[model samples]
Target: AQTVTQSQPEMSVQEAETVTLSCTYDTSENNYYLFWYKQPPSRQMILVIRQEAYKQQNATENRFSVNFQKAAKSFSLKISDSQLGDTAMYFCAFMDLSGTYKYIFGTGTRLKVLA
Candidate 1:
């Protein structure tokens, strides 16, 4: 069984501050992909960052970075210099090549960028 967990159902940070959202997963497979998605009021899912299970280094994009611990099965997203536009619902996702070409998403963490 594969599952993702976002313990924080809601989070808030001041504008221009940094915030980290935690995500823990449980999986028996070795090869997999972990991702963080952001969905705002537009209701569109945007990929924030992605990490491969085989990669030793974490994956980062612009102001977003991931702390991926393969051994602990944890993947957390760090948002630096958060802006008003960064306010969104963040979802931790997992995918693998087990013939199930679909993504498993966590309950989600609603992040608010307080001005």
Candidate 2:
């Protein structure tokens, strides 16, 4: 079983600033994938960054970076140079490699970039 949690229901950041969104997860499986997704008004879920549970190093994609703490089961996303276009609903997701390949998603956090 795997589960994802997004602590903040909403957040706001100034344009060109940096903002971080926290996420946590629990899983009985030994191997899994953690991900952050962004959904703008277009309603398309875009993959921001992803990390393999077995990896000790965090993952980064351009302006998006992740701080993955395996011991604490914590995965947080940091967005640098945030643009107004970055405003959207961010989701934390988990996928297990436990044969079932099940996916569990978080409640999501709505992030706003104010100019």
Candidate 3:
């Protein structure tokens, strides 16, 4: 079984700054995908970034980026120029692409970006 871990239960950042949220996972399978999901107060899980195990280059989307260390089994999300709207509960998720596509998610990190 695979599991994801987020050491930080909660984190805060000032608007217009950068914040990195940490995530680590344990998996025996070699083929899989890692993801960072953001859930705002509205309760919708949005895909923030994704990384394929085979990809050497990390995944990035605008202000969102991920540091994917395959050997270390570490995937962290870096949010640049944080905004008040960026405040949300971030979850690190894992999906085994070869299997039934079940998603295993971390406990979650509640991030608050203050103005």
Candidate 4:
């Protein structure tokens, strides 16, 4: 069984600053994928970034990056140059490629960018 945990329920960041969202998971599977999804008020899950367990380099997409610690089973997201549009509910998710291909997601972390 795999489980994702987001310690902070809510986070606030000043506009133009940077914020990092913590995410930890427990999993026995060796092959899997970790993801950070952003869901705005519209409720659409947008893929922020993803990291494969086998990849040594952390995944990065523009202003979004991930710190993937394979041994510790930790995956955290960093949002740089925060903007008002970045406000949303972020979710940490895990998917085991060797299993049923189901995603176990964290409760969520609500992020707000303040001007």
Q: Against the hidden reference, what TM-scores do the models get?
A: 0.97, 0.96, 0.98, 0.97
lDDT of 3 at 63: 99
lDDT (Cα, tens digit) per residue for candidate 1, span 1-115: 7899999999999999999999999999999899999999999999999998999999989999999999999999999999999999999999987887679999999999999
> What digit string (tens of lDDT, one per residue) describes model 3 on residues 1-115?
9999999999999999999999999999899999999999999999999999989999999999999999999999999999999999999999998769999999999999999
Report how far residue 49 has shifted in candidate 2, in Å: 0.7
Which one wins on lDDT? 3
- Candidate 2 clash figure, as a count: 0
TM-score (C-alpha, index-matched) for candidate 1? 0.97
Please tell me which model should have the higher lDDT, number 3 or number 4.
Answer: 3
- Looking at candidate 4, the ten consecutive residues that score lowest on lDDT are 95-104
Model 2 clashing residue pairs (backbone) = none
Distance from true location, Cα of 31 in model 1, Å: 0.3
What are the clash counts of all predictions, listed in order?
0, 0, 0, 0
Output the TM-score of candidate 3.
0.98
Candidate 4 residues lying further than 4 Å off, grouped into runs, are none
